[model samples]
Target chain A: MAEKKIKIIVAKPGLDGHDRGAKLLSRIFAEAGMEVVYTGLRQTPEMIVEAALQEDADVVGLSSLSGVHNYFFPKVVELLKAKKLANVLVVGGGIIPLEDIPELKKAGIAEIFGPGTSTEVIVDFIRSNVKAK
Target chain B: MFDVKELEKIKAGKKKWSEGTLAKTLSKAPEKKAKTTWSGIPVETLYTPAENAGLDYESKLGYPGEYPYTRGVQPNMFRGRFWTMRQYAGFGSAKETNARYRYLLGQGQTGLSVAFHLPTQAGYDSDHPLSMGEVGKVGAAIDHIGDMRILFDQIPLDKVTTSMTVNAAATALLGMYLSVAEEQGAKYDQLGGTIQNDVLKEIICRGQYIYPPKPTMRLTVDLIEFCQKYVPRWNSISISGYHIRESGSTAAQEMAFTIADGIAYAEACAARGIPVDSFAPRLSFFFNAFTDVLEEVAKFRAARRVWAKIMKDRFKAKDPRSMMLRYHVQTGGVTLTAQQPLNNIVRVALQTFATALGGHQSLHTNSYDEALCLPTQGAVTVALRTQQIIAEESGACVTVDPLAGSYYIEYLTDKIEAEIEDYIKKIDAMGGTLTAIEQGYIQKEIQNSAYLFQKSIDSGERAYVGVNKYTMEEPPVTDLLRVDMKVGEEKAKELKEWRAKRDNAAWKKSLDKLREVSKTDTNVMPTVIEAVKAGATVGEVCDVWRDVFGQYRPKEFIS
Candidate 1:
């Protein structure tokens, strides 16, 4: 039998309308042969967690550009943990400052990608760090 | 513009030179890569009179302030006065933003452009669940008339023109602004500013839309009709291409999509029985000034010519003012990079210069550190000074359409105009922009362009200076503006208190009136102003809209 494909959910949380990066990565992840599900703009943290559970996502990538990552990113992670999704890898990207990255990681984000990061680097990070389902 | 015999002689000379000297040089050095504009229009090795062979000077490139305003809208241009120097700034609480506004005005900035927080832009109060972590982050948090009062505190609304970058809640924001003006004893006729009330681009690129396209358009027309009757000096809608370009569209696509949107607005207004010339004059545009100086200049000129022709030929607008395409430009923010933060200053300077050459009526220069965080006061000051230096010292603004009649600029202007015409034709055939957006055609076109651009940068086909070309090992940037996390809690507490103190009976009556008026075809602007006056929060007014017209849920175009 063929190996199960990596299921990734690219989610946009909060009220940010800048989705050029989010939508671009969604296409890149799919082209990289992963099963990608993009939750459209203005998704609440709860809605994002529910989408992950329903999609059985092995990876949840959060994108926020309006500077709301500090609240929503970790909230999604905590919700996943409450649902016993501790093994699912969660990552974040957007206009996140370097100082805020360590706290986000401490809250269980596997990695945080800043601006000018290449798609190859992000895809490689996901492939290497995602826990097998 | 040249005579037939003169043009023939020049064409022959150019052919001979290209066949001999150009061919020999090409055989030796063999050009680096295919040359094209940012929009992929082919750039020739040399342009001459032949490039503008049958160009009619009168019709194609008319005098400034005339029909087919290819040169400019103002006859004297900057000789009358320099373009208004506006900076988009807001952060933290309303009082904090008010202080920043005062500081900017003190720095000699000519106009004020308000940037609202995402919660306010999306029609949510600071206390709403969706507003967590977002209040006072991107811009000032304005919930009710009280916050709006604090926002414009000492700044006299009558003396200074203010542009509010509000879309989904444009009505509420404009209502609050007008109410604050009333308190300041400013007459309605004296108010001069713009609101980015264009909602089609919100659906296409920005994604801050509240209702479906149909009802959102109704709200847009309602504001236009209201302003036409009462607020004659206010620009009702700033039909925008800036966000579309930031979302990664080519230059031609930006012009085409924006002009198409303008067409849709005029059509909607005409359908509402408002005369075409009545509201068309107040219709202004907002565009992005990218780093490509020549292409941007050409795009601006071509956009003016195209809009003039459309207003005259298609809309049958008779007033000369209705045909003018006055615009405001903001330096491209997507061009900034977090790698080498200071380089963005130079980029903004170049874009500002291009905007000047493009004959923009007003401009905003982005700060260097915006790629990392909100601009610090120091960075924003440098941005404003860059414009001042260019305006006072650069000598680029001394003449009207300084680059007009240049072989290359004229060629590119004609080419871009043709391209815009082609795209607008296609959109019209597809049952107009509204239907095209409903079918996801415009969204997919932009996405494809965005994907191709990223791929080029990733493949090293394009050199992005510090990002793709230059190698840099730099320390992490730490001196960035940080919005206090306590802002959300403070604003929520203030909203609760304000609600408790206000007369509930008046508030309920105002909201009920707004809901009733919104249901029918009556204009909602007067009722919206009354609701805000009665202490209705931004979220409360929008919730009535949400209950009436329903919220928009965009389909994910990416499979």
Candidate 2:
């Protein structure tokens, strides 16, 4: 039998229009042989959670360049927990300041990738951390 | 372990090599002879006078401010007046950004560049549920005329040239700008500025596009026609390659793709019974100044030459103004690194110099701390100072087209021009930018380049300073601009009650007109302006357009 592939949902929360980093990450995930579904730019937290649940994703890779993570990611985590999908890995990236990394991690962001992060690191992190239900 | 059979076969084949021949001499030439530069141009072992054989002055490279404008746009560029020193600033409420704009203007900035927040760029009001957390996060939040009024409250509309980096809601923003100017009692003819209203690039590079390509093209044509008739001094659209480059495109791709989009806009205007010469002269471009100094300079030279040729030959543009390619340059934002952030200062300084050498009409240098968070006041000042130091001290602007007549640059320029022409022909084969975008061809090309770049960095072929090579321990960032959390709440509250206060009847009337014109072949600018004057918010105007021209659902790309 074939080994199960990790399912990743790469989404842009809130209204951040910049998507170079998110799109790049999607390609990286796809090339790593993972099933990657890219929720296009400007997706809200509820829409992201809905997509995550429907896609049955094992990892949610959220990228925000708009600096709205303080309001966006926390809501996403709360909704995911309410929906009983807390085990799913939630990775974040973009122009995130180092200071907020701990707060985001506490709020259930499994890993944070800032600018200049290598695609290999993200792919490897997903492969290693995204657990099969 | 050694491949003795292959060695024996090679030795046998080289029978002419006598016993006197050394083992090294018996080996074949190196597999990788030439090096592939960042821009993908292959550098040969040596270049001589023969390389300059076909290229000639007055033909291939005319004088600055002349046809096939390879040298530069103005006859006395910078010598007459230096390029516009514009800084891209916008964040939090319109009032906040307005204060920043006033500060920048006071600091001797020659031009104004507005960077709208994501909600405004996406044609949504700050009160929209989708815009909840994002208001004022990336750039300034502008919901209606009230916000716009605050944006330019103290600034003189007639004196300064403003460039608003907006696309999806460009018509709405432009309408608001006109309304704001009118409210300030300034004549429409006296206003000058640029709207980065290029929608095609939105589909190709950035994903901030609202409507589908057809409606977006219509909007682009509408702006061009309106500018020609009323705001004759304003550039209708800034066909941007900056986002394309920031999205990981090569230098040649940036030039070719942006010019192709420009051609598409010109053609769209022609389809609307607007003459090419009438609207083409008002078209401007926005480009990114990347790390490769010589390559960036060559890219600009080739870009001007290629655009002039396209205007004259493809579109048959008659007026000289129509043939000139004027553009503003911003240093590549992606080049700034968060690690050893101060290094970005040097990167931006070099890139800014490249912009100067490339004959940019205006320039914005990225701040050192931008890779981390929004630039603080001191950081923005340093960013502005970088440009000032270059203009006042570097002496780069003492002459026009300073890099002109250099043998290598000319050769590289010729090569890049040829390569880009080949790309344009390919795009033409795909039925221009619209069809290419619809087919996801441009998106795929950019993604492929991005992937390859990532792979290069992964395999250690490409090195980024302070990232892949130089080791460093970063000091904690002491000064970073943290946005007030209340800004979003304030934006939401302001937009909510402002809607309650507007004249509903007039808003409905103008919106109805906009809806009717949006469905018809009429230029939508006048209708949009009427709507804005009637206090129909940007979100409402966009809703009408959205109702007429349905929202675009991006086609899926399977890697």
lDDT of 2 by residue, B157-232 (tens): 9899999999988999999999999888899999999999899998886888899888888887788788899999
Candidate 2 overall Cα lDDT vs. reference? 0.86
For candidate 2, the TM-score is 0.94
Off by over 4 Å in 1: none
Considering only chain B, report the TM-score of each candidate against the true chain B.
Answer: 0.99, 0.93
Which 10-residue window of candidate 2 chain B scores lowest in summed lDDT?
Answer: B14-23
Best by DockQ: 1
Q: Give lDDT tens digits, candidate 2, residues A1-133.
A: 7888888899988766677778777877777899989988778888999998999989898988878887888888899999999988898998888888889999989889988777888888888888778
Q: What is the interface RMSD of candidate 1, in Å?
A: 1.2
Clashes of each: 0, 0
Let me know the TM-score candidate 1 reaches against the reference structure: 0.99
What is the lDDT for B30 in model 1? Answer: 96
Cα deviation in Å at residue B286, candidate 2?
Answer: 0.6
